[model samples]
Target chain A: MSDTARDRILERLRNAPRQEAPRPDAPASTAADPDRGARVGRLKSLLEAMRTEVHVLPAAEWIPRLREVLQARAIKTLLYAPETGLGAALAEARQQDAAGLPELVAYSETVESFKERIFAVDAAVTTAAGAVADTGALILRPTRAEPRLMSLVPPVHIAVLAAEAIHPSLSEAMQDGRWSADMPTNLLLISGPSKTADIELTLAFGVHGPKELIVFILDD
Target chain B: MANEPFENNVDRALADAQLRKNFAFAMGNFILKRRAVFSDAEQTERLRTIGHAIKQRALSRLPELLEQLEAACTRNGIRVHWAETTAVGNRIVLEIIESHAAARVVKGKSMVSEEMHLNAFLANHGIEAIETDLGEFIIQLNGETPSHIIVPAIHKNKAQIAQIFHEKVAGAPYTEEVAELNAIARNTLRRKFYEAGIGLSGVNFAVAETGTLCLVENEGNGRMCTTVPPVHIAVMGLEKVVERLEDLPPLLRLLTGSATGQLVTTYVNLITSPRREGEKDGPQEVHLVILDNGRSRIYQDPQLRQTLQCVRCGTCLNHCPVYTRIGGHAYGFVYPGPIGKILTPQVEGLEKAGTLAFASSLCGACEEVCPVKIPIPALLRRLRDESYSSAPESSVPGRGCKQNWAERLAWKGWAFLNTHPRLNRLTTALLGLVGDYLPPAGPLERWMRYRSEPKFAPRSLHRRIREEGIADE
Candidate 1:
């Protein structure tokens, strides 16, 4: 039934008198040299305003910081992807932990098998593909190793970001990453923890997705 | 509510003090937030211009771009469906659900579905469709349609929501705390996400270059609905398609900033396909349903084509004086505010919905804040003229619906007098003599409902200028 509907709709659109409105030139190219320092500060303040926790640390200190974040929050189980480098390190760290860190669970199987377990985990840690400075967002391209639900289903989402991955704007991030040519099955730009101001315009966080978003900005 | 007269709806809404208070507070906050984000006038103007251009470009070649989008989506393993009207759109969705043998469906916020009245359609077929957005959930529980596009339950205060949740959700306790209310919704909806056989959402932008459906949302329910369920179906107005991925950044910025004053929403999900091989999660089947409804007819006219350029930012609603006072319910449509005034009459026909065009004060606030520069006030004026026009060339549905002999004759007489300078002058002089004694009744009564009648001066402005020896030029 809709085959004809498609043809009919497209036909109508084509037959319609064409509008001769001028097409605008491409948006002005962003500045060639974006001040990375100012962007980082803006990103930090923006995230903080949304109640997301941001920690700046040397590259080698993220693991320790991650442990502290888990301990401080008293997370019982931490979901991770064992295929990623950070995930392997987390596994190794969990193995050596005599101080009783959160139990590590690998999301290695299909969601059909891991759905209940992933949902029950206290927190999940994922590596952000990149970050947008202007909007203070963390971009995640869900690969086979780290699926789309990791950052969403868990109560707390802890993302690790290298300082260099931050872009001045979303346009720059898309252009620099060549997103248009090679797109992922699912891409996410998450700015803050899940929130809503629906009822009487009263702001509330952690409505459905992660209640807490903690970013570890690794300054290399 | 859908069948009620627009004026009666407005009267009832105005009479409700609580509704008035809710709208005032929410609109004020929305204005402040939008102003804060777009504080730099030059930058904001550039962005709006670029946004408007992008929409126009896409619309100028809407047919080719839609074909490109369909081809790209097909290559990505996502099935595409087209519907000329809402009935077909709803039927397509139902068939998809039946194919999955799904009885329970969880939905994210999609105004397109609201336009279809999809929930009611599904319920009639014995399919339970649950709304997962917090605002949507509250309104769904109360058996109400969304009052605002962005905030579906903006018409209801927290107390009213507490009452609805208490009465609707099983074993739920009444609480006015916003946090507690949100927690209740989260707890109730998460299980539905995990268990529902199908998930449905609305597309914010469909990229022709990449076949990606982008959803901008503050809540993660959008992510959850598109991810957790085994099958995901997305519905969009065909006009939401963009020609390229780069078109998204500016449009997204304008939409969020203008709608809620956010620099970026909490999540902007770009879905190109279902879960790929080796993926552990995400929906395995993704379907995109594009509904034309009355948009194709609307696109036939060059002037009305600009209406298709809207990004559904809802900023116009926040800034509209009429919307602030009467709220969304008074509009009696899927959309409300200035956009609705011009859009509804076109889609539903002027005969039934033409009165909405008269609801606006033509303040131009809506156009000033429109992200895509839709020229809403101009469109409103156009719709008003269409309602009264007897021109055969007017293509609008139910054109000249409001035309009557009384109004036509009055306008004709006024035109004739204005064309004859001597007679117009005589009439003015006579009005200056007796206008003050004219009764403040009849048609003037409605005009003076909230205003005082102006007393005409004994001398006309033209006479005063001549007596003062002012040059005619």
Candidate 2:
């Protein structure tokens, strides 16, 4: 940074209107409450209104339910993460099934390799840390291991979000301590399937992103 | 590339029944969704006030704000470059790519890059530029310009896309199913993401306090474009600067609500600098090119300066009745609709684009939805006046002759009418007769013929009052 540029930025900051100072002593572990559940329920309703299919399951049963849904939807290959619970479930299900229902692929590998695996598959399923109840959105933090292309390249995107992740607003999500440090540098908040109404304002689905989005809400 | 005139583009769009239907359905739905989202006029008014005030504050202290952003970004290890002209901006980007000896560049949707024709410039030097935005990618493959601000391929349908994909994505079979088509593109672009050495993106807003470049998108391509590649370059118009991070919330609310009727887009990635130490994935080096182009010139004109505040939400295009009928390409520029009418002339030069200023019906819809409250209609009128005055008088063959003829005729008519009221009445009666006989010839005659003549009020009001014994005061 040049001294001139640095000085310019400092000057602008000095001129800006001051805001109420942020409270620095807030607790990191804010208690989870029953209100979180109600928010999730309302979010589920919004998803329903948009014609998206939603399912809630216990953490233990989540993997089986996801496998069933993916199989039923004819999903063949998927992008996943071990840190997210859904990744563990899919792994367990794949091991138990002698007949490979769908291949579980990780995004950290070579792009050419991932493409080859995804090209044969029907859809991609990833895990979401949370969902914004107000907007029926899922938040996914993609890191080096979880390549960003997984979410966009697939036709149908299945996001597995824990019920505990539901937040009333994006501000609350940002305030969460988990996001402040080692924040997976890239966070994606998906609302619905990728769509465009650009051609003569005509609504067209599957333009740039996933055409269909399915969210699995886990209770455990 | 088609070399068709802008009028022909409008004609082509107007003739397409399916496209018209599609635009009607989409824009109608968007308008209704916006109304629902902003149902509380009072709340909207409050938001508008905050939005306008914040932008004004930022603009008022632009130099300082830009400096603060540059400092913060530098501390975070992001390289920031400033260019006073479009040529300089393009050159900076080209030099950056050249330093890396990069050949293939993949880009996220950046209107500024399009305005500068960065892709063509890079291609001229044997560098291949690919658009990662689906709509932009489709248009690029077709060798055409973006027709819509948000949806670049808005004029193309699925069948057309399927055909384009078949021809472009080597060995891919043609399929009309939306999913199958999407899969093909996904497969094709997956390799591009990894192979491309440089990723180019557009900055939606640059925070001066944090030196953060904010990118909002639905697809994850923006993240890929900014992160997956080793080198990331962001090109932004100089006016995109904001004073602080706190001002973002309201502007984001307004932009998402107005642009897509979403509470927020799927992704609002704020990159403070290049990937920090211990970070898993992001560009190794991040460069920001601030392009002034013709913006500084626009800032010189007080009334037109407000146009710099545009966030490019594209609500103006979405709500424009004329744009809905003719799509975006008709404007013959990257921007379209009411905002385009005012901006194109100023940015591209009025000498070449003066006619676009007169395209608006001046319905004031653009001003109503503008988050920053740019009075677009008034600016357009001002441009029109400027264009008219600046036009070479000698070029107009009969300019003085026409004015002299009109002046002579008006004085003669005024003298004749003032000297003989009866003759004037006779002439008026003759006009009425002639108007009736004309059979209502287009707009001019129709306007007069449709109105009732008032029957000369049966009798003068003065005469009636006198007969009734009322005193005329």
Candidate 3:
């Protein structure tokens, strides 16, 4: 019956004499110099306008600076997936700071076992696959190592990205990288903190996703 | 309710001072926010033009593109279904959940599902479908139809929401604080997200080129609906599909900018398929249901088909003078405002929704802000023409007192008298004497109900010009 319905609907469409409107050519992504500080400045300004906290630092300050934010916010029991390289670096950073900072928790073998912990964790940190400079959005491709929840379920999301990974637009990011070749199961473009103005047209933050999206732009 | 006749709804809406205040406040902010997003006029225009072209091309080649979409989705291991009517769509959804024997389903805001009334159908078959979007959740709790497309609970203020939450949800307290109200909803829905076996979402843009379903949202409940559950189902109108992935950028850019006046929403999920091999999470089973309730009939007409270009931004509602004045509830349909005036008649029988055509002031505010540039006022006029035509089969709604023989004869009589100069002069002289004294009970009274009709002059402009030989001067 579903097949018959499909056939009938498609047939109606097929029988209608096609009035083919011309397909549009997508605008080419503007190439920007990867080393340009102007791109970061623009990205930061845009991100801040969208209510994201953009932190710029020398390569050495990356981990230490993150520790400072976590300590200042009094975030206890930070979660990270140990298998990821960023997770490993985070572990080293924790050992270096080694006191008055949050306790570090790694992903248990499965997201199911630690589901309760994930909901209760103060914050989660992950490595951003890349970002778009025009929209000031972080493009995340979730794998088991840095699962979807790390950036989503937690109240605070700390994503560290190298400066060169910032593309000028979604079009540029699509063309420059092999990101689209084998697309991940779930791909996300997060522009700012989870927010809503649904209540009396009043803008409120931290509706269901992260309240704070603090980005660490490494100058590596 | 959509089932109600429009005039009664309007009367009720007009009397409710609160509804008017809500619409005025919401529309004012919506207008300001939309303007703020498009501060760069050049960039906005470029994106709007591209968005218009993308919709035009996809709709023009709808059959081939839909076929490509199904094929691509099949290749990507997602199930796809088609529904000729809302009833059929509801049945399909029920079947999918029944196969899994899923007891409960969490749903994101999908106007298509609302059109189908899937929740009532599922409840009859003993499945609870909980709405996850906070606005939708509130509406669901109160057992009401959505008054607006984008903001389902726009009619309700924070205090009302808090009151509803207190009464409906278990062990909940009432607080007028918007943030606290939001927090309560978040905490309440979080459990449902984890427990539900099936999740439902609306498709923002279904890219035929890649078989990807792009979802745009700010509150993140859409993510929860599509992500937390083991089985995910997406429902959309057939016209929602775009031909290529590249078409998405401009459409999305304009959609967010126009809707809430944001360059991009908080989250844009590009879902290619269910969770792949060795993946930690996401829905295991993904289904896409394409519904063609009455859109194909609209598509057959070249002019009326442009109405399908609406991206559901609610910008039209914000800018429309009539919509802002009467509020969405006056439209008496799921979709309200200018787009609703054009769409309701087609989706419902023209007789049922024909009166909606008159709801618009024909101000054309809707067309100006439409990212896809659908000529809404023109379509309303077209529908009005169809409604008044003598041919019932060819007309929408098929019945109208406005177009009845008495009304036709009155106009015909007036035209005939005006065309004959001698009769025109005699009638004018008689009407100037008596037009002011016409009884308070008939056609003249009806005309005077809203505003006083200006009395005609004792002498005609034509006669004075001729008598004075003004033409020669």
Candidate 4:
């Protein structure tokens, strides 16, 4: 009585009159557009429309540039995963710029113990696994080293995306292996800051996730 | 609330002027937003066709896909359960929570849970289910059902929300500022996210091949609910499954483009399972509850199966003039607008929800803007047909059981009169004797008088002209 529902449902579906639609063409992960450069430009404008501040810079200048950005914003503390490449660069920068421009906190402890402190942090930076140019979305494939909360809990989120990893469409990103069989437990695509229009249809940002989403696109 | 009939609900909703205005304004914005993103008409048509095909295929292959999804999810360490009815679905959810000994649960927006009244069930069983979505949270506090699918509290303006906050929310001051009100909810729910022991969410699309649950949301609460808790449970209708992971792209494109006019929602979480060995923060245990309720019955009829193609985009609601005029709660069920006009009777028993069939204007606006092209007006007509259909209940037969006497007689009279042109003209001429355009006597007559052309002009102009020999000029 408690569990026969599954069998009953399956049985019903099994007996449903068969109507099959032709399978869709295999997904193409890369943008079908002839002008790849224009897609990136279009992506930038779209992201900007969503109120996300976008920066397109070369790989060599990413760390120095991020340092300039952090100092410019006057963010008191920055949280990052030490295992990531960007995390290592930040660690080196923090040691060199040790005049308390921005305190760098390494997320080495378990989240359960440091949950409160994690919330109090001003900003967190993570490296995006891939991005969709059409939607201007950055994909965060959460791993143990760079946990899911880093991009989610903080008020400000700064993500670094490889220019080459940007796909023409979401379908292309998935078909091209950004989201595969052996993918992480959770894969997140962030289009902009957390927002809601529930209060009288007036749009307001930063309800639960980051208030500001700053993406650094590195053209290597 | 669920048991109230549609007629009663519609009357009450129509009497509320503020609710009508909110629906008109919000639905108008939604229309413009959805249209803006699909500027390329040809591409939009291509996607609509693809979306329709994908849904058709999924519904046709539902049994196989459900099995594959269950098997794949189990392999990925996610537990799977099923419920044939809303009550069973609630009981199953309670049983899962009972096992966890969880007290407080945080939930993202799940219309299926609303369908099951799972929050009420959980409360009855001594567990609290908190809706983290701001719109849902407001409706929950107000002790009202959601008025709109996308904007649940669309019926309330800032002043009303501010008043609710002042009265209900702890330490909240009376402020009609939208930003401040959002902040109050954010601060209040932020604490709940960390304290809640379990989280529940709805699935946007469940992939069969990889056994993933895809969710689209603009706010981060979905992320909080799925990730922050130790235990996570997801509930979805059986029709929400898709065959392949790649099939998601086109469906998602259509869904988001039609929903809020975004290229994509702010957040699209693809969850495969609970936390693995190395994951630092995520649910330790995950569960997926697949519900049947009455969806299987809908699938039995191939024509009606198209109703299941809805991606819950709410575009049809935005485009539906009738829905915009009267607003959501008037439909008197979990879903509202054109889709609800058809779906309510199908799921809740056509006999129980039969009046919903009459709620539509039979306008094709919903069908026209439907990303998946569900023949909504036709389906509504089918339900209307079922309501008045004289077929007796048979276990082997279809959805509705009741027969409407007046409707049957009216159709009979229409058939008889239309077949005999002499009688039809005689009756028309006799009615025309009531002074060409007499004042409408009643609601039915008022509508009839306006819709019908004035009795055939005394004599045809062609005959008069030919007789007078002025036709050549």
Candidate 5:
């Protein structure tokens, strides 16, 4: 990234509206809904039906569980976060895995560094604030740590979503447009694996985005 | 250039029994499936109404809608550019690549890009633009324009494609097996996806409310082209806008069902902006280039404005008997069909492509199947009228002129006979006398070719009625 481009991005970020914290007194509408349990159950069943494995955990336990999954799979996993502790946890994981274990990578807020990390890793795991129950979509506010290509180019994708973040419909998701202002230049609503039927209407998987998607649900 | 006339291409295609068989089979299945899907007349009418209303709403408030869309997209970090012409559209895309200092650009199937000939333009500027859509990729490798709008290489056979792949890709063995050939293309294009610095796509619709660009494709290449590359640029015509996200479903249903007889395309990507935080896999930088390209000029003409409502389902071509016989190449435009017959002349100018208007049989099949209900036959007639008026008198064949002369004389003689009963009787008797004197088949046969000779009545109406005493009564 050129200095000018970096400066421009910084300036844009500085001028961007600060994200409003969730109302503390507000009811846990998403989590408390009677349908939330059913939705998650259905999502798990659907994923299982598609031959994908699902994992459930608390948010506090996600980082460790993901590291374990990546190690078991023997594939390089890159974690993207702007928070300092998240980076520290990833680094600690790498140090623990020094004896020829799976590589654990972490990206920060710098676009160039983020780009470098994305190209190096085979799978990407990121956190989404919400997931749409209707279409099995995960919504994330991507930043430098989660470069657009990271989610796409990798063969496998794991998106961790907080239980309270799930939305019932896209319309409800759109109602929270303020959260979208900080959105990257592109917002993709990916339902399932990347697939194509271009050649003689034959379905082929993994043309662009991850062919396999694993959603990790976490109770906040 | 191939040094082959359009007719020669048609002849070659006609001779290819396999290609004809494949095309006929596909077209027949598509027609049957689409008919079944849209069996309910009332539902189809409602869908058409909704689609037309949405398109009309977008067109009426285009400037306002575009600004709203731009604002929403920009807030989400997507860059929006406007192009006034094809050259500008191509230039804007090339500039996006140059800014990234990209050496290679991988593109998904985009008809607008093809219309702009952006690949060649980019190649001239020393940037490689590889098409990623299988049909488009095959045609691109062959260095030919798309024969059909939906199926670019519809005129080609499997063997022909295998030969092209073998000749183009070094060390690649020829294979008639579909799966092996697909694997070869996949392996070749997979590298391009990873290496290309930029991706280019075409927009199916741009939602003004959310500033989202929707792309519907059966192939995952569209997803790859838009997501794998760091930077993504989408070029769309100005007419491809709809007012709200709610309007998408109906249009999508109609487009999918009418185009390929699918319940829905395998993939429907709705990109609001670029990549956001904590997201994996999407373009970091997204640029949208909206093109006008004489659309506003067409908008000014009420007779032709309905063409803007076309969703490009290609049903018109499939049902067009003439198009099925001659195929798409003879029309000589990016769009080839009944819609092309009207649109090409308007966009490229009537003087340049006037004869295409005369290609139709005016059977009204295209108008019947058109999803948006564009009055194609009426438009064709208007184009023909324009062609005739503007065409030079010397350009018309002498045989046509002779037929016109005979028709005019026959009408004049009928008018003269109507004014005088005695003259009518005399003319009737003269016709009988001439018929008796003429040889069975000689010069009269040549005259018959120019004008049909009416069979002589046995007796005049007045004489027969008088003999029957009906006149006295």
Candidate 6:
């Protein structure tokens, strides 16, 4: 049934008279900024405007900052992917934590195995593929280790972005990463925490996804 | 109410002062926000032009692009389904759900699904289809469709929404506070996301190059719906396909900036496939349902094809005076406002939706604010013509269904009188003598309802010209 429907639809589309609109001229190109600091500044302001808490720190201090923020927010259970480099570092940090750090829960198994536990998790930590300064968006290419829901599902999402990886815009980030050529199974450009202005156009945060998004910009 | 006369719906909507106030307040904010983001007129126009071109380019190669999109998605292990009608689309979705023995569906914001009336279809089949988008969830609870595209429940104020939540939701307290309402919904639907057998979403942009289904949403519900469930099914109008991944940025920029004046939506998800091996999360199976749903017929006409270029931004509705006054419900369809005026008639047939074309004041505000430059006013004018045209060449479905002999004869007589110089002159002279004394009655009654009857000149222009020794030519 679907095959016949498909064939008929395609045939109808093919048989339809072609509508010729004026061919669009190439888009006006904004000059890519050569300065990295400008990109970082733009990303910070944009993210801050959208109510994302952004902390730029030396690589050596991100762990301490993450620990402090988690403690401040009273987060108890932290979810982390077990295989990624950042996850390994977080595991190492948890091993050496004196006190006040949240309980580190490694997502070592399939989500079905720990769905309830993960939903009850206070926070989740993951590494960003890159960042777009124009929109203050974190580009996440979820992989086997850093699964899609690590940055979602939890009440809070703490993503680690390298300062050197921030690009001028989404187009620049896509081009720099050559994403189109070898795209990941899932790629997301998340600008802020889950938000909605649906009810009477009033803004509300953390409707379904993580209410709080904390981005640690590693300056190392 | 979908079959109600357009004028009747408008009258009912106008009578509701609260609905009018809600629309005015909401549209005012939207208009201001859009203006602030696109402050630079030149830059905004350039972006609109690029966005327009990309849509046009993609549409020009639509058939090939759809094929490429199918192949690309298939290569990525994403199943692609085609449906010529909404019924077929609904059946395809049902089959997918029943295959997995899943009866619960958590749906993200999808206008196409609404057009399919998928929720009702699923309900009839004894399946639970829950709306996850905050706005959509509210309206679904009230047994109503979306009043606005971006903001589905824009017609309801906070008080009304609080009442709906308090009444419909079990153990939910009445709260007019936005944050509390959001939290209530979050706690309510969050579990549904994890428990649902299937997650359904509308595709914003279906990229052909990388075979990606892009979804833009502010709330995490969309991400949750596409990620948490084991099976993810996305439905899109066939025209949603873009030729390349690079075409996304400008279009995304225009869409967000124009839709709600956001620099970017909170989440822009690009799903190329379902969960990969060893992945701990994300949907295991991904299905993309491509629905034509009268779009192919609309594409047959060169001029009318512009309708497909819409990106579902409600800026046109925000700028439309008629829409602001009447709200979206007055249009009585899944889509409402200026875009709906043209789209519904064409899709549902002129016989059913022809009155929508005449609902517009033709102020051209819709076209001016349109991100893709879809000449909405011009399209509305064309639909109006198609409604009256008994011509065989008319492509719109149910064309000439509205052609009444009395109206046609009146127009024809007027045209005849104007075409002949002597007849026109005599009519004008006769009108000069009695036009001032003519009562505000008959066809002119509606026109004079809002204003006093106009006083005619003592002499006709041609006669005055001759008396003043001016050339009559």
Candidate 2: which docking quality band? incorrect
Candidate 4 CAPRI assessment class: medium
For each candidate, the DockQ is 0.84, 0.17, 0.65, 0.73, 0.14, 0.79
User: Which portion of correct inter-chain contacts appears in model 6?
Assistant: 0.92
Query: How well does candidate 4 score on lDDT at residue B82?
Result: 89
User: Candidate 5, B378: how far from true, in Å?
Assistant: 3.8
In model 3, which runs have C-alpha deviations exceeding 4 angstroms?
A1-3, A25-35, A95-97, A108-114, A178-181, B390-402, B414-437, B459-473
Q: Which prediction has the highest lDDT against the true structure?
A: 1
User: What TM-scores result for chain A when each predicted structure is judged separately against the true chain A?
Assistant: 0.94, 0.75, 0.92, 0.89, 0.66, 0.93
Q: In candidate 4, which residue pairs clash? A: A29-A172
Runs in model 5 deviating more than 4 A are A1-122, A125-147, A158-184, A213-220, B1-9, B32-44, B67-80, B99-101, B176-180, B218-220, B227-230, B261-267, B271-285, B318-326, B361-371, B389-473
Instruction: Give all candidates' CA lDDT scores.
Output: 0.91, 0.72, 0.84, 0.85, 0.69, 0.90
lDDT of 1 by residue, B208-268 (tens): 9999999999889999999999999999999999988998889999999999999999999
- Maximum-DockQ candidate: 1
Ranking of candidates on TM-score, top first? 6, 1, 3, 4, 2, 5
Per-prediction TM-score, please? 0.97, 0.76, 0.94, 0.92, 0.71, 0.97
Query: Candidate 1, clashing residue pairs?
Result: none
In model 1, where do residues sit more than 4 Å from their true spots? A1-3, A21-23, A29-32, A35-37, A98-100, B461-468, B471-473
RMSD of 3: 2.7
After superposition on all C-alphas, the RMSD of every candidate to the true structure, in Å, is 1.8, 7.4, 2.7, 3.4, 10.2, 1.8
Please give, for residues A1-220, the per-residue lDDT of candidate 3 as tens digits. 3358888898877766567688777864554554447778777888898799999887678777887888899999888888888888878877876765688888755555667778889999988888887777888988878777788888898898888888888877876875446667778998888888777878888887888999999875
Pairs of colliding residues, candidate 6:
none
What residue runs in model 4 are displaced by over 4 Å at the alpha carbon? A1-3, A26-36, A99-101, B1-5, B391-473
Instruction: Put down candidate 2 lDDT per residue, A122-186, tens digits, no spaces.
Output: 67777776877765677777655455556666778787788988987665676663443334445
TM-score of 1: 0.97
* Candidate 6 lDDT score relative to the true structure: 0.90
Which residue pairs overlap in candidate 2's backbone? A8-B67, A8-B68, A9-B67, A9-B68, A12-B64, A198-B154, A199-B154, A200-B23, A201-B23, A202-B22
lDDT of 3 by residue, B162-280 (tens): 89989998888888888888888888888888778999999999988888899999988888888877899999999999987767778888899888888789999989898777777
Q: Order of all candidates by lDDT, from best down to worst? A: 1, 6, 4, 3, 2, 5
